[model samples]
Target: MISQHDFRQNVSIFENSLKIEFKVVIKSFVKLNKLFILWLIFVPGLLFSSSKNDSLLQVYNKHHSDTIGLNALHEYARNLQYEDFDSTYKTNVLLSNLCFSNLFEKKNLTARERYINIYFLGNTYNSQSIYFMEKGDYVKSLELLEKSIQWWSLAYKDYLESYKNEIYLGLSSSYSNKGSAEDYLGDFAMAMDSYTKALRLNDFVKRNCDSSLLNFVLNSEAITSFNIAMIFENMGEVNKSQKQYSKALELFTALTKLKDERVVVTGFLGTSNVLTALGKIYFKKEEYSVSIGYYNRALQIINSLNLKYNNRFNTEYADILTQLGIQYKKTQNYNRALELFDKALTIRRELGNKRLISISLNNISSLYYNMGKYKESLLASAESWKLAEEAKVPQQKIKASEGMADSYEKLGNYKEALIWHKVFKEVTDSLTDQESIKNASTIEARYQSEKNENDLKLLNAEKRLAEQKIIQQKADMASFQIKMWSAIILSLMIILSALITIFAIRQRHKRILKEKLLEEEKNRLRTVIDMQEKERTRIARDLHDGIGQLLSAASINFGMLGKTSQIMESESELFSSSMKILNDACTELRSISHEMMPRSLQDAGLSTALNELVVRSFKNTSIEAEFEILGALERLPQLVENGLFRICQELIGNIIKHSGASEVIIQLYKTSNEWILRVEDNGRGIISADTENGIGIKNIKARVSVLNGSLNYENGPEKGLITSVKIPIYGQN
Candidate 1:
C-alpha cells in the first residue's frame, strides 16, 4: 500500500541518523592515551612492512584468516593510509568486509577491557576514514567518521572511571576530525558544532589529568579555536573571526610556557599557523605595519621548526613568505618584497603544487608592475596564467589576466592592453555565469524532488478513496443480516440476566470479605513499623539525654582533677587513657543511635538525609562516596520515605562490609510521576543466584513491593554492582 517515493522521503530522516559500530575480535592490553595509541598500534604494522616479504602476505601467513586475522587486517589497512592505498586494494576490501560483518561481540570482559575492545573498533573506522579522505572520497570518509564517533561514545561510557578522562580525549579527537569531513561535504554549521564539542571536552580533561598532558591539551584547544576562526572568516564575520584567533593565540602562548619537548613541537606548529592567520586579518583591515610584524613573527617560528624538524613545516614556511611579501609590497618596499616573493616561488616549485606556483607567480607579476618593470611583469603574468589554467581555478585565472592587462598598459602597448582587458572582462563574466548556473541547478533539483513527493501523496490518497467505496458497499449488504439477529439476541439476553445477577450477588459478598481481611493485614504491618520507630526514638532520646550527659560530666571532672592536682607523669598518662576509653564509648553510643534513626531523615527529607548518610559513613573509611539528587523534592508519604531511607542504609552497609569497592554513589531523584533510588558500587557484585536470596536483598525487595515499586540489579564479575528501585508517586496512595 505504500508508494516508493513517499516511503523513501519519509525514511530518509531516520536513515541519515543511523549509527554503525563494531567490536574488535582480538584483545590487547595496550594503554589508550590519546593519539599516542596510534604509535602503539601502527608500530607493529610498520615492522611487518619492512620484513623480507610483502606486509599483507606476512599478516595472512601469521594469522591464517582466523579471528586474530581480522585484527591483523585492520592494522595492515591502517598502515596503508600513510602509503599508496591502491597498492593493497584487496586488503582494504577484506578489512571493510570484516568490520561490517559485526560477527564479534563484547563479552566476558572487564569494564576496562571492554572499553579497550570498543576503542580498537573505533580506530579501525578512523583508519578507513583517513584513507578515504586522502583519496578525496569524502562521503565514505564521513560515514566511517560518524561510525567511529558511535563506537568511541560507547567506549567513553563503559571505560573504567579512573581512565574515563583518557577515553574522553580520544573521543574528542574523533569529533575534531569529524568536523573536517563535514567541512568537505559543505556543511559548515555541523562542523562548527563539532569543533566546539572538542574544545569543551579538552577543558574537562585539563583540570583532572596530569600536568604533563597540559601541552597536548593546550595544543588541541588552540587548533580547534583556529578552525572555528577560519569558518567565521569564510562567513565574512571579521570581528568574530578575530576574537577566535585571539583566543587561539592565547592558548598557544600558554603552551609555549610548558616544558614538554615532544608536544612542544606540535605547539610550535599550531602557534605559527595562528600567527599567519592574524597577519592576514590585519592585512585585510589595511594595518600594514601590524600585519608585517605578525607575518614576520610567524615566519620566524616556521623557519626554526623546519630547520629543527627536517622540513616538517616546509609548506607552512612557503605560505608565510608569500604573505609577508604581499605586506612588504603594500609598503612599497620593492627590493625586500621581491626577495621574499622569489624565496616563496622557489619553495612552491619544489612542492609541485600548480595552484601554489600560480599564486606565487601572480604575486611577483603584480610586484613587477608596481616597480615599473613592464616586460618582467608581463612574462611572469603569462607563466602564471598557464599554471592557473592547468590548476582549473577560475579565481587564479582572473588575477593572472588582470595582471597581464596592467603590465601591457604600463608598457605603452595600447592595442595589446585593450585586448587583454577585454579578455579579463569576458572571463570574469563567465565565472559569474557559472555560479548562476550552479545555483539554478540546485533550485531545479529541489523542485523536482518536492514534485515527486507530492505526486506520491496524491496516489496514496486516491487508493484510500477506492478502498472506502468498497467498504461502503459491503456495509449495505450486511444490513439485513443484522436486522434478523437483533430479536434473537434480545431473547437470549433476557434469559441470561437472572443467572448473571445471582452470580454477582455471591461474588460481591466474597469480595467485600476479602477487602476487609486485606485491610487488617495492612494495619498490622503499619502497626509493627510504627512500634519499631517509636522504640528506636525512645532509646535514642534516653541515650542522648541520660548517658551522654553523664559521660560528658565525668570527662570534665577528670580533666579538672588532672589540672588541679600535680599527679605524677605516669599516673597522669594512665588517667588520660582511662578518660579516652570513656569518651570513645560515649561517641560510639551516640553514633549507634543516629545510625538506627537519622534525625535528618525526619527533619529535612531524602536529599539532605542521603547527603548526611554519605558524610557519616565515609568520614573515616577508605572508600570514596558521592550522593546526588535530581528534580525538585517535596516530602513524600512517611512510609515511602522511611522505606527508601532504610533500603539505602542496608545497601550501603552491605557495600562497606562485603563489597571491597573503593567507590560508591547514591542517587535519589524524582521523575514526573515516580521517585527513583539508585545505589551503585565498583565492587564484586552478586557471586551466585543464592546471593539474591540473602536477608538484606530480600528486605530491599520487600520494601519496594510494599510501595508498589520495582527493583532491578546489574551484577558484574570484573567490577560494579547497581541497585535501582523505582516507585510510582501517583498510585501509591
Candidate 2:
C-alpha cells in the first residue's frame, strides 16, 4: 500500500505530466491551424473589396459625360471612405474644386447643370466633414458640415420643384455629419436637433423618391437615427437611446433586402454600427454578458464584410476587443481577458492612432491593476497618460490618471497615489466644466433662435393687425369684448384651484393609509419570527432535559449489566456494544439540541457564535473554514442575532452538502448604519435551478426578509460562490 505522502507525490507528478502534454497539444494544434484561421479572417474582406471594385470599374468603363463621370467619381470616393482614408479625402477635395471651377463658374448654365454642381459640392463637403470628424477635429468638421449645408440649400432653392427628394437626401446627409461633430464636441442637445432635422429630411426622401433612391434614403435615415441614438446614449437617456437604436435597426434591416450591392453593403455596415452602439449602451449599464453578445454580432458583420483591415473597421474591431476583454475580466476570465487586451493593443499600435492607443493602454493598465500587478499597472498607466496628453483627450487622461492612482495605492505609495488622484480629479472637473459650458451654449442658441422666430411671427401678426385695423375701424370694440370675457375666465380658474386642493388632500390621506399598512405588515412579520425562535428554544430544552437524560440512564444501566459476574462472555460483549451505542445516541442528541438553539449564541453574541459554528462544521472534514469580523461587533437584538446565526448555519450546510467546496470564509462586519454578513465558498456556483429548489436557500431568504435585509448570491472573482447579506441597523449609533 502507498503511504499518503507517496500518493500525493505521484498525483503531483501525474498532474505536471498532463499539463505538459496539454501545452504540446495546444501548440501543435495552433501550428496546424494557422493558415486556415488566417484564410478565414482574410477571405470575407477580399470578396467584399473585389465586388465593390468591380462595380466601380464598370462605371468608369462606361465613360459617361463629364457630369456623370463626376457623379461616378463621388460615388467611388464615398465607397473608399473606410477603405482608404487619405485617398478618399484627396478625391473629395478634387471633386469639390472640379465642381466649383468647371460647373459653378460656367456662364448660362442649365438648371440641371447647376443642380448637379451644387449636389456634388455638397456631397464632397459632407464627405470631408466625416473625414475630419474621424480625425478628432470637431471644429473643422463642423465648419465643413456648414459648407455642405450651404451647398445643399442652394441646390434645394434652385430645383426644389423638380428634384426636391434628391436635394433633401443631400441636406440630410450634411445634417447627420453636423450632428456627429456636435456630439463629439459634447453639445448633445444640438446634436439631437441636427439628427432630428436629418431624420425628417430623410423621411421626406423616403416617401417621395423612386425605389432605387428610396433605398438610399432609407440607409441615410438609419445612419441619422443611429447618430441620434448615440446622442441620447451620451445624454444618459437610456430609454430614448434604445428606442432610436431599435428604429435604426429596423430601417437598416429593410435596406439589406435591396438588390443594389452598394446599398446592401452600406446597410450591413450601418447595422453593425447600431449593434456596436447597443453594446456600448449595455456595457455602460453593466449588463456585461448582454453587451458581449451585441458586440460579437457587430464583429460578425465586420468579419463578413472582410473589412477588418480598413481604418474604420480596425478601430471598431479594437474597441470591440477591448470592451469584450473588460466583460471577460468582470467574469474573472483573467487569462482570456489578458489575451484580448494584448490583441487590442497590437491593433492600436499597428494603426498608430494615439487616442485609441491611449484607450488600449489604459484598459491594459486596469487589467493589470485587477491582477494585482501594481508596478506593471503603473507603467501601462503612465504610458497611457502620456499618450492621452499628446492626443489632448480629456477622458482618456482621466482614466489613465485614475488607474495610476489605484496602482500607487495598491503599492503602498500613498503620496504618489494622492498626487495622481488629485490630477484625475482636476481633469474630471475640467471635463465637467467643459460639458456645462457646451450645454449652456446649446440652450442659449436654442433660446435665441426661438426668440427670433417668435419675434418675426409677432411682427408679422402686428403688421397684419395694423392692416386689418385700418380696414375695419371696430378693432377697439373687439378689444373691449376680450376684456369682458377675461373676468369670467378668472372665476373658472378659482374653481379649478379649489378642485386641485381637494384632490391633493385626498392623495395625502391615501399616502398615509399606505404607510400604515406597510408598518402593520412589518410588525406581523416580526411577531412570526419571534414565535419561531421561541418554539426552537422550547424544543431544544425538551430534547436536552427529557430524551438526553433517558438515553444517558440507559447507557449507565447497560454498563452496569455488562460488569455483572453472572453474565456470560457473549452476553457481556452484547451488553458492551449496547452501552456504546446508547452513549453515542445520547451525545448526538445533545449536539442536535445545542445546534437547535446554541447556548454560545446567547452567551457570547453573533461573532463568537459564528466562529464556533465554522470551527465545528469543518472540525474533522477536509474543508478549511475561516471567520473574520470587522468593525465593532456589538450585541444585536436577540431576534436579529438569531436570524443572522441561522443564516450562517444554512449557508454552511449548503456548502458542505452541495458545493463540494474545499475552503469557506464567513465574515460579519458592521458599517456606519448596517451589519453585513458574507459567506463565500470555493465551490461550484449556485445555479438558477439550485436557487429555486433548495430548501436551505428558501429558509435563508425568509430570515433575510424578516430582518428587512438584502440577500445576494453571485460568482466570486476567481471561482466558486459568494453570498452577501446586509441588514440595516436602525437606531444604532
Candidate 3:
C-alpha cells in the first residue's frame, strides 16, 4: 500500500541500516596508538577507556603458559568485550592456543593448576559468547555459551573449594549473557530459565560469601536484576519490571557510594541503565513528570562520564531522550516533547542505527499528531514506516501506520486514511494469528514433554523398586542361612545332652534294684534262721522237763524196792506203777516227735491226717476237736501241704494248751481257685494282746505269707475264737 516514494525510502533505509552496522563493526576494533601511550600513562581513567592495555597484554604474554598468565589474559579479554568484541575474540583465540600448548592435557600439572586452566578455558569461551551476543549473533552466542557451561562444570567439580565462589560468579555471568541473547532471539521461555538459573547461583554465592566476596556478589546480583527486569518488561508486566529495576538501582547506588575505584565504573553504568528502565516504566504508567525526572537523572550520569566515552554513551542517551519525549507528549507539552524527540533523532541518525532511528521518528510523528500538526505528522510517519519495514520491526511499523492513519484522518484525506488504517489492521492481524499458532504449538509440545517425563518417572521408580527387592531378598536369604545353621547346632547340643542324661539315670536305677534284691534275700535267710533256732529251743525244753521227771520217779521206786527186803502186796503194786510210768514216758516222747514232723500228715492228705490228728489229740483230753472237710480232699503241692499242716498243728496245739474251752472245731475247704481252713474253739472269747502276737502266731503268719495266703484270728459270734486261713491254688510254690 506504499507509494513509489515510500518504496524508495524503504530501500534506502535497508541499505543505510546495513552500512551503519558495518560501520559499527568496524569502529569496535580500535587499535592502540603509540602516540597516546604517554598521555594514557598520565590519566589512568583515560587509559581504561582505550580498547587495549599494553601492560595487561605483556602480563598475559609472560604468564600465558601458567595459571597467572591465563587469568591475566582472561581479565584483559573480559574488559575489552563490550568495547571491542573482535579484539576479545582474537585474544581468547590466542589464550586457547596457550592452554593447548601448556597445561590443558599435560599430566605434569597439579590438580589445582589443571583446575585453573579448565576454568580459564571455559572463561575464554564465555568471553567469545559475549562478543557474539554483542555482535547480534544470538544462535552462535547460545552455542558458545553452552560450551562454556560444559567446560566450567568440569572445573567446578575439580576446583579448590575456597575458589568455588569464583567459578560460581563466572557461571552466573555466562547464564545471564545467554539469557540476554535468548531474549533478543524472542525465546522468552528459555530466556527466563537462563535468568532464573543465573539468579539461583547469584543468591547462593551472596548468601554464603564472606565479606571479602560480598561486593562481588552484590555486583552480580545487580546485573542479574537488570537482566530479569527486561524479561518482565517484554512480558508486559511493567510493575514487576519497575520493582526489579528499583532493586537493581538500589544495589548499584550503594556500590557507587562505596567509591571502590576498581568497581565504580560498572556501578555507574548499572545505575544509569536501571534509571532508564524506570523512566520507561513510569512513562508507560502515564507518570510524565516522574518519568522525565528519571530520564534526566540517567542523562546526567551519562554526562558525568569522561567525554572519551561519548560514543559508548550515545545509544543510552538517545533511548532516554526518546522515553522523555513520549512522556512529554502524554502530558500535552508539545513543544518540549518536539524538542526532546529532535534531540533523540539527531543522536540515532549520528549513531546510524536504523531501528533506533525509526523508533525516534515514530515518537515524533505521534507527538506531531497530538499537537495537531497533521502534515508534519504525515511526513514523519511515512518515513518512520519505511524505516521500520527495513528494520523488520513489526511493532514500530504498526505504530507508524496508526500515526499515519490518524494524521490523514485529521487532514480530511479519507482515502489515504482508510488505506493506512487497513495497512495497520492487516499487519496487526497477521501478528495476532502468528502468536496464536505459536501458543498452540507451545501447548502441544509442553503436553508431550510432560507425558514423556511422567512415563520416565514411572519407569525409574519401578527399576528402583525392583533393585530394592533384590537387595532385600539377598539380605533375607543371608539371615535365613544363619538361623538355619544356628538351629542345627542347638539341636545337636540338645540331643547330645539328652543322651548323656538318660545313660546316667539308667545306671543309677539298676544299682538301686540290685541293692534292694540283695537286702530282701538277707532278710529272708535271717528270718528262717531265727525260726529254726526258736523251734530247737522249744524241743529241748520239752524233752528235759517232761522225760526227766518221769524217769526220776521210776528210779526212786526201784531203789525203794531194793531197800525193803521182805515183800508186801503194796510194794508189788509200786513196781507195777513204775513200769506203767515208763510206758507213759515213751508214749509222750512219740507224741512230741509226731507233733514236730507228723507221719500221718506226710502219709495221708491234709483231710485224713487232720481227722487222725483230731482222733488222737482228744482221745484223752477233756477238750474235744472237730475236723470237717468241704469240696475234694485233693493233695496240694509239697510246700503248700507242709506249710498248711504246720499251720494246722500250731493252731491245734494252741487250742489244746491255751484254750479253756470245752470243744474245738476244724474245717478244711477247697474251691476252684483256693483252699481254705477254719478252726474254731469254744474257749475264752478273746486272747490277750501278748498271746496274739506270740512267736507261734508269728510263725503261722510267716508261713501263710510265703504261700501268699491270709490268716485271721477273731472271736466267733457265739463267744469262741475263730482262726481262718485261705490259700490260693495259683502257682502256690
Q: Please list the Cα RMSD from the true structure of every candidate, rounded to 1 decimal place.
A: 26.9, 32.4, 33.5
What residue pairs clash in candidate 2, if any at all?
Answer: 44-306, 45-306
lDDT computed for candidate 1: 0.71
Inter-residue clash pairs, candidate 1: none
The local distance difference test score of each candidate is 0.71, 0.77, 0.73
lDDT by residue for model 2 (1-733), tens: 1122421333444434534644554555435553354244333433445565556535644743257667776776766655667667876765675565555236776778777877887889898887776665667788888777766666655576888777778878888889887776567888888888888888777777887687778778888888888888777889998999999899888888889776787788888888888887888788878898899999998777765444457667777788788878888898899999999999888877677788888888988888889999999999999988876667788889888877876776656766776687688775445443343333333444545877655655785687688657667777777887887798889999999999999999999999888767766766776787898899999999999888888887777766665788677778667777888899889888878998899999988888888898889789999899987788998888998999899888888888888999888998888899998988988656865577877778778877888999889888899999998899421
- Order the candidate numbers by lDDT, best to worst: 2, 3, 1
- Residue 6, model 1, lDDT: 21
Q: For model 3, how does the per-residue alpha-carbon lDDT over 41-101 read when each residue is reduced to its tens digit?
A: 3233333434455666667556646888777767776666445445567767656555644
- Please count the clashing residue pairs in each candidate, in the order shown: 0, 2, 1
Please list the residue runs of candidate 1 whose C-alpha ends up more than 4 Å from where it truly belongs after superposition: 1-114, 117-164, 178-190, 204-215, 332-339, 352-733
Better of 1 and 3 by lDDT: 3
Report the poorest 10 consecutive residues by lDDT, candidate 3.
1-10
Q: What lDDT tens digits, residue by residue, belong to model 1 across residues 1-733?
A: 1122321342334323433322232233123442354344444445435442255546655663345656666556644432334433335444444443332433454554444445555666666675565444566778887767666665554453766566667656776777766765546899888887787778788878887666667777777888888888867899999999999888777777777654566577778888898999999999878887888888889888867655646668988989888888988999999999999899878767666788899999999988888899999999988987765545567788878877866676645665666667676675445443343333333444556867646655775697688778778768766876887798789779978998899899999999888667656655666687788888887887888889888888987987898999878779889889988988987887787777888898777877888899888899999998877789988888888888898888888888899999888888988899988899887635666678887777767766768898887546789889998998666
**What TM-scores do the predictions have?**
0.40, 0.49, 0.46
Instruction: Assess the local accuracy of residue 246 in candidate 2 as a C-alpha lDDT between 0 and 100.
Output: 96
Tell me, by lDDT, which candidate is best: 2
